[model samples]
Target: MNVYFHTFGCKANQYDTEVVRQAFADRGAVVVDDPARADLAVVNSCTVTHTSEAKLRTFVRRLARGGQGLETVVMGCAAALDDGTIVALPSVRAVVGGADPGAVLRAAGLPAEASLPFPLSATRSGGQGVRSRGWLKIQDGCDEHCTFCATTIARGANRSRPVAEIVAEARLLAAHHAELVLTGVHIGTYGRDRTSHDTRRTTLGELLEALVRAVPAVRFRLSSIEATEVDDPIARLLIEAPRHLAAHLHAPLQSGSDRVLHRMGRHWYTAATYRKRIEWLAERLPILGLGADLITGFPAETEADHRATVELVRALPFTYLHVFPFSVRPDAPAARLRDQLPPAPIRDRAAELRELGEAKATAYRAARRGARADGVVSGRQGGKVEVLTEDYLSVYLPTAGWDLRPRFEVTVD
Candidate 1:
């Protein structure tokens, strides 16, 4: 049998897809890139927002029409949260929870292995396939009690993969010549669940230290860390670590107002403290890229609060932003808030922040002009070769005798 995997949403989902794909391959199923050519189509879905849900529906509908003879399997956070909506779709043959991807494979007539001996191991070699970037799952799930989030419910309690296991996977990724990106639902909470009574629990900083020591040749990037987790030790390692360490950090500042944060049940340092951490990192790291997540038009977010958020975002040194309008999930505390902003105001605020984000990104790219940086040449585009720097900056260089996959130090002039 031939299978095609469609992945949507976070890096963790993508990582899960890889695990499932490898499982199918182990069972003698050929992986195909085209849906029409496959016997089965599995969509690892994401429901971070309504827009993502729509996309999943559209893809399933299209696949159903295009892949008339194939079985369609739907699984992931989106499917887990709203299984009835998806399973009712004419195309979907099976709906499985995000927590049990292995079950989806089994239901689709694939092998029913209890679990892979090492889930993080990838079957693809030589970096010759569609995946150039690698996502390493160091942690899974969340323990934070944020009122507006559905992730905690979708992923359950915090679970940390052992440090030795992560190190082994990092070594494998390094050997494959792929840059490894550390990812999790709540990555900052690494080691909290696995701590022993005899020893102080290992922290994200220590885990990172172990990875760097185990696989010094691999470029390592973090998916995202909470603002509260961006402490001194981690900050210093990010600043002074070897060149293989990614020069980018994504810290989410859900809201700028203390009242809004408190209402959301998110515990973190004050906006002032968050600002200082960003400043400290920017000053220490070379060619640093700072990204942030922001939510606009939350319940009880006064006009003054919105204004303060805009000011704080503008004053900060963030190179990019992921702006989202607050969406109330079915069972979340924020869903019942009485003072929710109207749809028009929410849309307007999100649009404003998006515009601001674009301008900041352009300014950051402009600053890179005339500076030299190291990047891996990924592919050819329009007679020029494209490369991505460690900090995730994209650069285009004229394709003149440059090796396609060579790591080169290029001047961004």
Candidate 2:
């Protein structure tokens, strides 16, 4: 059987797809690159935004139109919370909820006995084949209940993988890939679910310490984490071990207004607290790749609230930003809230925030010109191999005479 996999939203979803892909491959199914060549399609869906779900439906419908007798099995967050909508789509043979490889295998017509280990290792670096980097999922689910988010409702509470198991996967991935990205729904809350006697690896920082010690050859990058959870050990690694841990952090700042944040049920930190933590980190790392996710025009958000968010974004040395206009999900708490902002203001606020983000990114890129940095050969584009820098910059270099090492030192131009 030939299988093609499509993933929507987030690196965690990407990692989940990899797991399911490997499970099929282990059962002797050929993984195809295109949906047209496959007999079966596995789509890992996301419910982060209404748009994401819409895209998934559109993509699946397109696959059905290909007329190759392709049967799709929909899984992940969207599948978990779906109310007969996804399965109702044409060519969808089955729908398996949540990020479980075993459940996906069973849904794909395999018997219960055919399910492999939950977090199985890939034969190559990535899902498709050998690649420059791979995603290593350390945990799953979210414990926080942000009002604007349906992730908690879809994925459930935090459940962490064992330290030894994660280390084993990292070792295997490191053998084929130059870098490993630690991905999860809420990576900042890693190890919080463990009530075991050994507390040595109970934190993300400690987990990094273990990963670094186990696989020193491969560089590890965090997918996304909370600003407040940047503990001392993680900070120490970023400051001291640049080769082990990349100097980049994508901590989400959903809204900078305290009122807006409180309304969103983001009780972890206030705007002031977030600023202090990020500013401290920025000061320590001279060339940090700082990014954040900001939501514009949330329910009951005022003009003053938008201004506060803009001010906070300007005050920080952000390299890039993810500006999302609030989309109402029927299952989310924000959908039920009063005084939801209209479409016009939401679009306008997102545009302004995105413009600011572009300026910051352009400035950061220009500043790094002619500087030497550590990078990995990601892919080829227009005859030049794209070297993704440790600080999240892409520097294209000549493909000729490349050493083909796991990591490379390149001069940004």
lDDT of 1 at 199: 70
TM-scores, each model vs. reference = 0.94, 0.96
Taking the tens digit of each residue's C-alpha lDDT, what string does model 2 give over 316-413?
A: 99999999999999989999999998899999999999999999999999999989999887776676778888999988777775667657789988
lDDT of all predictions: 0.79, 0.89
Best candidate per lDDT, number?
Answer: 2
Candidate 1, superposed: residue stretches over 4 Å from native: 123-132, 196-198, 377-385, 398-400
Q: Give candidate 2 regions above 4 Å deviation.
A: 112-115, 126-130, 197-201
- The alpha-carbon RMSD values of the candidates against the true structure, listed in the order shown, are 2.1, 1.6
Instruction: Give the worst 10-residue stretch by lDDT in candidate 1.
Output: 123-132
**On a 0 to 100 scale, what is the lDDT of residue 371 in model 2?**
95
Per-residue CA lDDT of candidate 1, range 22-102, in tens?
A: 777777888888899988998998877767888999999889889858879998888878748889876678888784656
| TM-score of model 1 vs. true structure | 0.94
